[model samples]
Target chain A: MANSNLPRRIIKETQRLLSEPAPGISASPSEENMRYFNVMILGPAQSPYEGGVFKLELFLPEEYPMAAPKVRFLTKIYHPNIDKLGRICLDILKDKWSPALQIRTVLLSVLPYCLLSPDYLIFSIQALLSAPNPDDPLSDNVAKHWKANEAEAVETAKEWTRLYASGA
Target chain B: MARKGKEDYYSDAGGDDDYEDYYSKGEDDVCQSDTDDENSGSDDGGGGGVSDGDDQQAMETTDDIEPKDREKEYDFETEDDVRRCQDEVTAKTSELLSVPPGFAAAFLRHCRWDAERLENEWFSDERRVRGAVGLAAAGRDGDVPTALNDRPLICAICFGGYAPGEMRSAGCAHYYCHECWRGYIHAAVGDGSRCLLLRCPDPRCTAPLVRELVDEAAADEDRARYATFVVRSYVEEGTSKYVRWCPGPGCTLAVRSRPGSRLYEVPCACKHVFCFRCGEEAHRPASCDTAGAWVVKNRSDGETSEWVLTNTKHCPECRRAIEKNQGCNHMTCSAPCGHQFCWLCLGSWKEHSGGNYHCNRYAADKSEFTGEKTRREQAKASPERYLHFYERWATHGQSMTKARQDLDALEGGGLDALADTFGVPPTELEFVTEAYAQIIEARRVLRWTYAYVYYQDPERHGRLEFYVFLQAMAEGAMEQLHKCAEGEKDALKVDVGDYGAVFPAGYAAGKLAEFRERLSHLSRVTRSHFTKLVEGFESGMAEIVL
Candidate 1:
């Protein structure tokens, strides 16, 4: 019922996301709202958050494709770029967003590598966990901690990932 | 002889109001004759026999000397003028760069409209310039596949399959559906003026979505908005060094200061005058820095510090500020630091027993109280000094508004009524208009003098006194003119209930003529005094001793 009256583009993206789910990521549309998706991203390997599963929520606004999708973390994690309330500081989610970018491209994409799409370099939630940009941080305190003492900050992040992001 | 010659020339022209033609005849003749006849003409004083030629001579002489009187020269340009300027630059850049006007405009914007720099960069390295400007360096030759393909291709955006010709791109192979392109442009335009630099929706593509693409794909409203942003960018960022939009509310005019001119005061066509440097109301006689500081000082809670010094006493133990609303001499500091002290001497209240209060006596600790006493006295004196000038500054500003309102009332309907009462044409009441104009100008100069005096160096021993004297002279002349124009004119007004019943035609005409003469003379005097004040301030009061 929620899928009724959804745009052809959104329906197509949702179908592709379900049939060929990206590696280490799962997303499913909420039953009450076709635009809302419950998302889960596995922390990238070799990162401090390696064995954790981070939950996120994504919603395509009415002005989707024209506007960027709203994505926020639901699980608590100690990352410089993600604030306590789970806002992100990614450029693609804000000013640098292009209409060409799909929900899969933002969450996790398995598009075949091609020369035409040279800018597509695995812009995924796991990639964000792997490379937490501390410079343009959403959390000032976390960024300060990350800048002042990175190794200690990484240990705190690892502890938080184990305590909060570990899916029991 | 030259005055006679000029008068004959004006008379021969047959239009007494041909001041523009008279002025343009010869600057030397006007200046020379102005000096010779201005004093005698102005000094003739309210004589019933004063001719129209003499009045014209007096006014024209004032105009002739005005260029030397003020420093800055500027021209007000309307929004259409700005667009014309933009088009001219776009055309010039297009011809020079050997590109279309749209591309030229984009290139000019990329280089901040510095055509010389764009030309230099384009000549030296075209590819780098193209890349920097977001143009496809691969050239627009065959990159755009506008020809219909055999098979329909899927658009990268919207995930919708479209016919080959239905997809569009900005001279790049990264094609998206027209609907998506329109949405992207709409969103960018809605964001604000940054849409002027909108690039292709493909992230990796360096192709700029030029005006052609916007015109072809953007919605009607977005296209208009994009055009506005383009023109605004040309004025705001392109020629920002010399041109500035007038800060007047809802005014689309701009003022372009002459290049290398250091003048700040700019009067827009909307009659809203402002400082070009600071964008504040035109404040002459005060430097932009001083005017800015004075405005902040006026707005901030500066009096709070002074009030604290006078009304509240700090707790002796914890230094917490405590105010005594209503109580006896004994004061107790609030909780957490409940220090008790005498209000008068700030001595420990423990020493003063009940019904034996003698805290009124000065404490025996002169060294302890000296600094506090001096600081308190200084704080008390500071606001008084500030208020002295502030009250006058604010009074003149209010007077200016009231004078403007009076002028408006006179022009709106009062002039015709007065003309009917005096049995003269409404055009004959121009002296009243001139008087109000003089009052407004004098009030503006007088108001800014207070601001200048507020920041005047106190160590400049006699300079402040001299400047105040000049300000008083200007203000004194202005008040006389204001009274003659406002109060005296009101006295001449025949009551509407008893219109023409009390005063005879001859008596009313005589009164009107006398009032006009006095108002004109006062206007001239006030103008001269303010002119001197401006010159004195402009020269840093060099004639007076420090």
Candidate 2:
């Protein structure tokens, strides 16, 4: 509440997300830093990512709405958009950032897109930077490995989720 | 009769056409015939046209032979009436039927002047006459036998020649190459000719093989050929739809006509054929519109709605919903009742029942229920309680009110207080924006009237009304909570549960826990869901917007 610009925006978004935080995801701010946060997403049960727990890290900059905040995966997982650094590849987190969009809307769009379907370019920075056409893929490795060998990828991700995110 | 050789089949054409791989099928093969010009087809495999058929047929032909007599028909003469006229070529053979009257030209045509077979044709004018007649019998321009059963017809599958005596007949009036026929019969199960069908060798012919002809007096080769025709017919569906038949080596069942051609729907028959097109064991409705063209036009837009739910009091076909809608018309509902009826005959089926009120009986008392309320308000006041009255409705086939009123009852509660009381996890609810606070506040005010009324009156029937009103508001509040979770997939400190595509069991459990956790900490449930919003997770939302 101290910072007029940042606090009001945070308060507003915080309220919206609490009211409805998507279908399978759970999220909260860290105790130490109100601006730094953690999230819990139930793996889209119908998708390959189902039954797994995923954690993410979000940090609001001094200038947030004007500039996109940085959100990254704290846990290593296989996805077309999120890279090794935990940085999310969503367009809203980049040059496409708009003032009209809020935290709740941005996060709402993320879950069903990431966990459900294979289309991550909408929320992925890497997918956009490399493979522009959804038809062709930038990380053809993931795309091919996922589309062709989906069962293997699903098993491996589940193993990783159980070993890491969903466990102690 | 020409010997059934690859070289001989192509000898009629005499040119090294690219289709050298596709040996022309002659009428001599029982199941097939020479491909008309329309079928100059090549396949990916070298025997593309009949790779599977050719290999299978070759094995079958080899298996049937007795080592004692290897009869190869070489120097046989064809019938004189069907002999060729010069210069006319049939598309089936792709060659001139007879020699031109000129000697020099006819000599050039056979390539007789070439090196190997003869040094020269000069002295033997008699050799020339012999060559002309030889070329004519090749069915180049001659009207060789086209009757499927009488002549050894070409097997449509293997493209091999069947010797005249080797051919047998079937119901569909088609023939099969003997080698192919033997394999076909061997592949099928049963002593009954039902497995065997005598069919035409012409490609794309929809005709089925006559079962009786093959069943009664078929040779071993003919029986096998008939079996193959029957099985392939089952797979083809429309003409010979296989509902479900045990493809065992010797099952003589023809249960294809059985209703519900499904895996478990297979009613045990002494005989059976599973129609592949419809899961029904027997005949499937051939067409959708043709079966009964009942279009479901949306009352509002006059546009056709896709949800064509047919109404039925009892399962029509099996009288069981268990097998309902299995096939096109004759819906074999999977219910134990075994209701088998046409979907069209059942009529239009709207959700016949409502919350504690069946539309049928509800329609009668509709005016009594809507005395003071508008339709939308009535819809909103669902989950209403009529504790004792509900017993009567239950007997009438109506559902009852549920325990959980709205999503808020499950999700948002005294969350902030409980979070402080239990010293538990901080607010995990994601945010959409506080801009909707006014709208939520307005709805909360709208919702409080029922709660206020419930508070003021303990015995009044109005108490149930207010409880239902609160449930509606709670539902809207829950909708907001789900909406925020959707946008935060890429945010920091993400949980594993946010990605449920279809609400799964695990997701439901996690969500319930999360909802309970949110309600425990908060004091007042807000229609805006602002109370459920925690101080944390906002940065992830902010990051996502970036």
Candidate 3:
């Protein structure tokens, strides 16, 4: 397998992710590049995008755990924090990133279920959907809409999810 | 005290050699004698005794006197001085707060180097201050477990197994491998001065990665950079309002203005003079606001708008700018608008046809020309007025630059050439150096005076006129002095090969002496004129204004 020369950390994390995937989350390494992963995260239960399956492309740079992993949405989803270019505005991906944070903690694991201590905060995709911080927004128009009338904004997000993230 | 005429001054001082000797004694003597004339009633007596036995006594007295105001206003500080200042502050804070120097430095930085504020907050609520500044709690200072366990442990960062000796942790015992710690510190250091505020790699840990940790883990160059940032933060963020980094490019020196004095102009050791208040080049006659506004106006495209207003006429219909290249009165704007109008009246061209070309004559109504036409005229006049002051300001700036270049040339090799031609040593030509320096100083004053005058309320009639008169007088004297220093020096140069026949024994000496006298006399006149100009401006020409 192309994963032969991968770091032990990456190999262990991939094995764990495949064997015991987080609820509503699935991630597997791509065939060609072990550092590249194909991830599918189902929206949280009560969110507007609950029935939607959001695909994301996550790449572990050479800096790996020292730097945050580069993740972006592959499927089009309407969210205040996600811009039209699929770039997410999350703290861990930027100046707040720490060397100790792992891909699972960044993408999927819930606070209680995370193997890392409960205090090790996880800004998982589901958590981000569950609480979209419109204050620190990447998409200005969506944030304005969300601020002006959140219910209508949520309806528009649901419509977008139905159209673009139907898991066809 | 009687003012000495140019001729009387030179003649009274005696021959060229004697006058040169008088000047070479130094400028301090001239200032001393001037001040003595004002204070002591021994004017003529002291003046006469300047070349005699009293000269030594005068020199000795001048040496004891210092310009007290200048000495108190500002001081130039080197890099070491700034570092010493930082160390003193850090030590005092550390002693008072009962904390390590690293923590003290961090607290000072958090409080913007305000030691008093840090003390206030620390004493008010130590725990809150500690939390805010990312310092560990008091009792947990030495509670970091020794990383000497026998069993291997996994580094959460790299997920690698290492013996306890290879691992490191901050007060919060979240261990990371040495390699991972080094990499993290290196990355943070690369980010910039903010690296000084870096925390531990544990996402949840609030333990600040202090300077000691950085010094131990950072690479050689990164460590040096981090050290630089630490030192700079003290000066740049310190609570001391008096000290400021010299704004000169690549200059590492800092200037400390006096605590209560309002003196804003400071000259650095590098010879770059700047206004301490605004960080701009020293502009004396103009206030900082006027100079700043002038500089901004010069840099912005306001002049381009003015030029467009003067050079091009806007199409009456579309308002697109159109320039008339042809001589015909009928004008056609190009492309889409294609509006046709008379160039003079800016009326429809059809009205001018059938020999009804009366647009040249004044309209009897006069109301048609009042509003827009008058406004355009006023707008055109405004740019012309700005250009008048701007051109003179720019011209003086260019003259100053040229004079500086001349001074540099004289210092470099021109002095030697003049000496060779004049049959004297290079040291004898110091008058030329002094002349160029005076010209440069005068040029700078004159340049900023234009900016000052441009901002003066034009409604104040006699004050501005008197200022202009003073400025003109100074400019005239400066021109004469500049001519003597630049053109006349070249006139003294003769071919070296024709040295023997062209001049006899006393001829070169006589010519050199004459040139020296003219140059020195002009220099003094120019200096006095500019001094008067500055004093007049400083006094706000209030005598005339009243």
Candidate 4:
């Protein structure tokens, strides 16, 4: 049985987020699902991912206390920590946790950060594809592409965004 | 294995015997000389260790200040009897329940000598006052020396003989074996609290246990005995006085008194006679023919605990040898207290074998006493009066806990969004005090935080307090957490490079979901709060960026 506070805490947190002046972004659980939420982030003006809103999916686990909720990207974007499948590797969302850390702080750090890092994408992703960084790399083809032809890598990334992201 | 916080209670009471006697007799020693001082100002009641230094010299100081007068000068009291040990273990243990009332209360009064007192008078030394710890080195005057011939290895607190391996040395140069000292201190602060009262084992010396010395000396003795000793400044709680048997061999007697009572009675195998308040063997409670064998039973279910029984040598733990009172076979011990209980209903408290302090912390919520109900009205009967008692008892500390939990709605996936988190179920109806306690707490905490917030941003601070006020009106204290969310996100950014302190329990539950779900649709970060919100973005995303 749901304790009466279940709906209450949820309503309080949502109203708390919406009425607050949180510039260019607002996120909340869809009206139907209490455990899942939809997020909206405005692109940074100085970044390549600018002028676009991005989205992601989050799943809270039963052992939420000892473990972090599993978060994944629903948007298709080119980034180092994010793969084509939208799998993200964040620490605060995983093992290195303290009892003090909470949800809103996680949003304040993770989403905007993934959009800010274009250098890590080139270095880590290039290393992942063309020729592995050996010490660090997620895929080999992009890494091989980076080491062999730098121009080709940028062109390929632009081409991928144009096609997959409707940039064309 | 014991009732909530009860194990230490009785075990501590065992150590309380002689200590309480010491303080009750303390006034007599001082009054013998300064008969006029008997009614001295209450402030002089327990003058911490005698640092009345030069004053003694002016009166001529050659250690003429007897060790027995130490409590009078310092007020490092012993309980008047076992029943009122002190705040440390009074409520949990039946030990105090067994002690006579008067002696225990006297000892308890002097136990909490505050830091202010410890500084201004206790340790000053300029006042010609000296404490009991200073005496082991400074020989006693003409009074009979308390040192027993060989000392028989008995614990000064419990009056029971100490096993060779179980003795604790205190700052006052006195000692109690492992069982008594460890049990006493443990009851004061659960276990390993480093609690310190450091007084003489003779029961009345008021001094620190020179704890540093015991640490230095622990090398040659049994590790367990060393564990028994401790020294700290916090007052002991829990070991309130209860009448108890003197641990003295062949003495086999009990006292009926508490800490502050002026009169006390002691029971002996033949005819018990003793004054616990005055520490004199004057009058006894039991008559000649009505004593001898003491059979103490441990009954998990009973009214008014029984720690000592006369005329029959029964073990305190097993009423098997005892003709029990309305007892049944539902016994148990859960953790360290090893208290017995009815296996099925889990109710009742009982006495354990010699010196064991096992007992229960609850009473059965359902009362079966029905002698007056013979003329029962079957058509319409009233509901039981104690029905709500157990519920209230069970949720005792729930409101103050502030424990926020995350329950995953993953099995069937009907949860639409993570905006809502669950609050604990209130144990009572809407009108109960617990529901309001949360509101009161929220308002109080908001008040304290208001000054700190105002210093950070005066305008934002005023607005924030008003926001919290709205939350209080809407819900209660815990719901007040919702009010801090926006401000918290703002605060998290300013200190992101050092954002370690701002984390709360549900940080990831909402933040991560919002960040990830929203980031999927975003290709830019042009928002203002975006800078503030991103304080944790890099580190937080680092976990999922793999």
Candidate 5:
């Protein structure tokens, strides 16, 4: 790991995030591993996944800042881009990652309701859930069902979110 | 007489076409050759049995096979060669800019080393060009003030306070502590990032860092690794149009190809020759795509499955393949399925029992030939066809391998000993190794030629009858060359540890001279024949009307 500054940067970002938590979004570092964060985001209202709380896990590996952080959904969700294993095919999490990006900016852009730009990865995922693009999909079976019947697929997605992602 | 017969045969077979123009132009040479042969009153033995039509075919193929392009040359021997090559480009750019070579090198690398494109962009928008290459304005202020209340300033990355003089700033004036800069550059290099063009540590500023600053900031080990990345960048990213890393494993040499030349086989300084086009082992007489496809197909287990499908029948119940050697039309699955069915029609065994076995002599159905059965028969024949070509292909491949090893042993002191035994200089025996290499190359070509011919669809590609004829000629020449080389190995005695048996002193130097002459002759003949064969294949093997 280069730059004895990664841990310092993460601490500063964590402090700012706690002091000014974005509405409906929270991220706290685990006690055992300071680099690992447990995160949760409330689903946007008026969408099929409304009123559900989605949990995610984010970790900064040894080569943090040089490489992007590894982030995945711990709560199951039905979306064309996110597969059954919760692996999100988001661009910023992969090849399009810039060292300029950090955790606060990532969550702010990815949440369906708090989308800052139309071209961001989270905005694309939200749009994908509302209207799935089956041609370049990650889950073949879900894409097939979505293509064969749109209303039924939406109902199934809502049912999955209510059963698995509902938080007390 | 042969020329007249050839003309008559061509007109009769080809009707009226553009090919007639080719024949008419050759009339003069044919007449002159006929007169010369008559005057000499001599006949060639090889030409005695061949017909006039065959003579015309050979002449046409030989005409088509001659190479039309000039051969290219490239040589890259050392790491210094790469540095010098890059330096030449940098020097040119520096002269035009009137700036330091280091600055020019960074600017050129940013533009992928295309100096003209950089010049175009530089003249079009000077400010944007300067910003892109990270040439900051001379009087621009640093991100941090030169001094803050006469106290030490804190570094943004490590959040550590340092005296103003303790920190360093690049051309962009983005100041960072020395330790932090070293760690940043070191990690960047460790990740295989193109660190030569690493930018300022301040994320908001996209100012590119210069090598001089990086050298001052990095430790000795990281600096050395940074220099390596710069050199490799010249081949991988900087000057990729003409230079490439040698495809041989563990070979550090780079091959520089002559610009604008057709891709050809390149022999590296390491003695590993490969196709510059596909970067594979040299595969002549077969195009790069065809040779690559053949190698990939040869590695798969599809051939075994095809063999199983052709040789056995699947049980109707459990789908297990069963083979019957000597049985009536009645057959039973040998597996736990134990399903009984007719071998001929695959009908249930109950229908063919109790005198219903009369179906054994049943007549053929037209529907069977028109449908899946025909496909099954073709699949059965497919493996046999492949084996026929593969066996010959593999034999030549084996011979080529042995010839390569023999050539290596000969080069390793065998040539010197043979020269001493024969009372001659070593240069006189050089042709022996040269001949063996030529034979090996020709055998490799012959081996892949079979695969090339097998993969060609005759109906679609206009049945390469002429190509096959040239291939046979080349194959015959190769076999003769192979036999001569193998026979020479048996007769020549050498004291190499395990290479050859030593001969008695009674053997004369005259016999050795004769053997050398034969080897040289066969090597030249084999090369010419294969050259003609490659030409025919490349020309799409134009059909001979007869």
Candidate 6:
């Protein structure tokens, strides 16, 4: 949590995210840890998570910029790709990450889930949530239900979003 | 060639078997390469006909020396050979690309380290080559801008304005502040990206970061990691498909087979042997695909779970595996759960009275497969069949392990007693050491042969009778050898010095000599049997014409 030696690039990015916050999202570094940020992302319109807000925690490790920041959802929402532990199955955070990417870019890139087409951006997070891919699902039960009965799966996802994320 | 040193023991056995045939075949292959080297030299010196003729004569004489005589002369190399091999590629690529060695290495890697392919592609389209490697053509007058040390620039990633001294660019000449570049390069390495080419930060500019710029800006740790990435990229992707790192854990050795060579087992420098066609442990007699499938089928829990599903029922309460051994309606789980239930219906035992036995009626719809009876019969017979062979294989395998341990012990101290009784040098017992090693090798081959037959379904090969005969012959020879060395621990334990006193009647010399001769004879027959079996597989059983 310590930020005694926080790099200038991280500091500058933190100030910019707060000053020019992206639409549908807000993030701020903690007072104790400049590397740690508390984030809130409003669910995209028409998605299962519509009318709800999801809380997430993001941390820049000691090797930030050289390493992707760790991000995990604190609020639980039902989706096939996202696991129960809040891990988003996003490629940009893994093998596809390039140094040209920034925290703002990543957030914008992930925000369109449920609204965008599957191949949009060649990796659409929205398409992933709107239409779960059972082949590479993070939650096996959710994937199975989505495959066996779609209407029931969508109903459970809506219920979860309303219960756990609506007040956030 | 570590193999050369060990091969002498087999040669001394004086058996004109296929074991020696295979050894000489490998040597002959190397001999062909040696002559090719001489031919290239003579062609280069063709202009000076007389001196060239003299040179050719000398080369031919040197080549004529028996490969056996020079076997111990060549030095054995390991991982360092891999590094040297990379250096050769880097040097060749540097010349062709007109770039520094480091830049050349990076560029060659993007081309998958095939220098010939890179050359062909570069000559066909220079512009595409430059663009593909992320280089901008010589920035005006063939000079790459050294460092942006003279002016200031705005970093594209963080939007930080920095002094020109802190800016760098790739071939496209789009510069970014040094801080951003460092972070980007480090992050790329941390994420373990296999992309050897790092592109410019400007979303539109596809120019890759050149090696020189990275060397100047990246930290020592990042630079080292980048170097490793460069080498691995070349070794794994850039080289021929046949080149493979030894699969032995913690072994840094690699081997590259001769082009067009048939797939065979390779014993790596680390002493871990594996099949080249598939990187599994050397499994002979069975083809790579068959062995791989068999290993997976045997290891998966499907068989065990399926057997339990068909043969037993879970306890109604505890859910533990329970077999209905007594064929009774009432059953009590032996576990602490001690739940009682009717085996037929899995219902409460107390409810099973007069007519409750109706649940015992045969369920005709239980199996969907039409050949259920035959399948059940096969299922019952397979393990019994597999066990029949696997047990013998496993026993010999254990014997091999024990023989190796015994050989190691004999070499360590038992040699002194052996030498004292024989009145010969300790080295005289080297043959015994080799005999034990041959036993181990033969046992391993025999073991896999059983596995091969288990899955091969000899009936389909139209030579079931021939397969049975050959299997019997090979197994019979191996079993005799196994019995002599292992089945009776005291039978072949030759502490000749102890035997001298025990056999004061003067039969100790005859006994020890006979023991050595028998060991050699068994090893030879076992070797010949294995060679025939392997030849049968290589020929796809065509030798069994019937």
Q: Which numbered prediction scores highest in TM-score against the true structure? A: 1
DockQ of 1: 0.18
lDDT of 5 by residue, A1-168 (tens): 232344676788788888998877799988777788898877766566777788888888876665778877788877555677776655455544545467776676544522111122243333333333333335656645655675787777789889988995
Candidate 3's C-alpha runs over 4 A off are A1-8, A108-124, B1-68, B140-151, B283-399, B423-428, B441-481, B494-546
The ten-residue window of minimal lDDT in model 1 chain A covers: A110-119
- Tell me the lDDT of candidate 2: 0.35
| CAPRI quality level assigned to candidate 3 from its DockQ score | incorrect
- DockQ, in order, for the candidates? 0.18, 0.00, 0.17, 0.00, 0.12, 0.21
List candidate 2 stretches off by more than 4 Å. Answer: A1-5, A119-140, B1-546
Best candidate per DockQ, number? 6
List the TM-score for candidate 3's chain B: 0.65
10 residues in a row with least lDDT, candidate 5 chain B: B42-51
What share of the reference contacts is kept in model 1?
0.38
Tens digit of lDDT per residue, candidate 3, span B53-159? 22223223223323343334455566776677677778888888877677788888888776667888989988888887676676644423223334588988768
Model with the higher TM-score, candidate 1 or 5: 1
lDDT tens per residue, model 6, B335-391: 224566655556665554322333433254223212234335446556668667667
Steric clashes per prediction: 0, 152, 0, 182, 0, 8
Q: Each model: TM-score of chain B?
A: 0.68, 0.19, 0.65, 0.21, 0.63, 0.64
- Kept native contacts, fraction for each prediction: 0.38, 0.00, 0.38, 0.00, 0.09, 0.21
- Score residue B173 of candidate 1 by CA lDDT: 66
How accurate locally is residue B8 in candidate 6, as Cα lDDT from 0 to 100? 29
Per-residue CA lDDT of candidate 2, range A55-119, in tens? 77777775554345677667766654444555444545643454334555456555445555443
Provide the overall lDDT of each model, using Cα atoms, as 2-decimal numbers: 0.67, 0.35, 0.66, 0.32, 0.59, 0.58
Model 4 lDDT tens row, B1-546: 011112222223244554465445332232132323222311121121112222233222223444334223211222222222223332222143232221122222233322222234434551232322232333333111122223447554344565554555543346665554444433323323322332333423543333333333333342233333221111222221323333335643233333332222332222222333323332111111111110011121212113222211122232222322211222333211234543222344333212222223213321221111111221122223112322322232242232211111111131222112212132211111211222222322222222212122224566546434543343332443322332443343344324324566455434533433333212111111111221211111111000
Q: Which residue pairs show collisions in model 6? A: A66-B187, A113-A126, A114-A126, B112-B238, B136-B171, B148-B164, B149-B165, B151-B164
Tens-place lDDT per residue, model 3, A1-168, is 655778887888888889998887889999999999998888776777778888888999877776788888888877766778777766577667887878888886321111111122336666776655454446767765766677898899889989998899
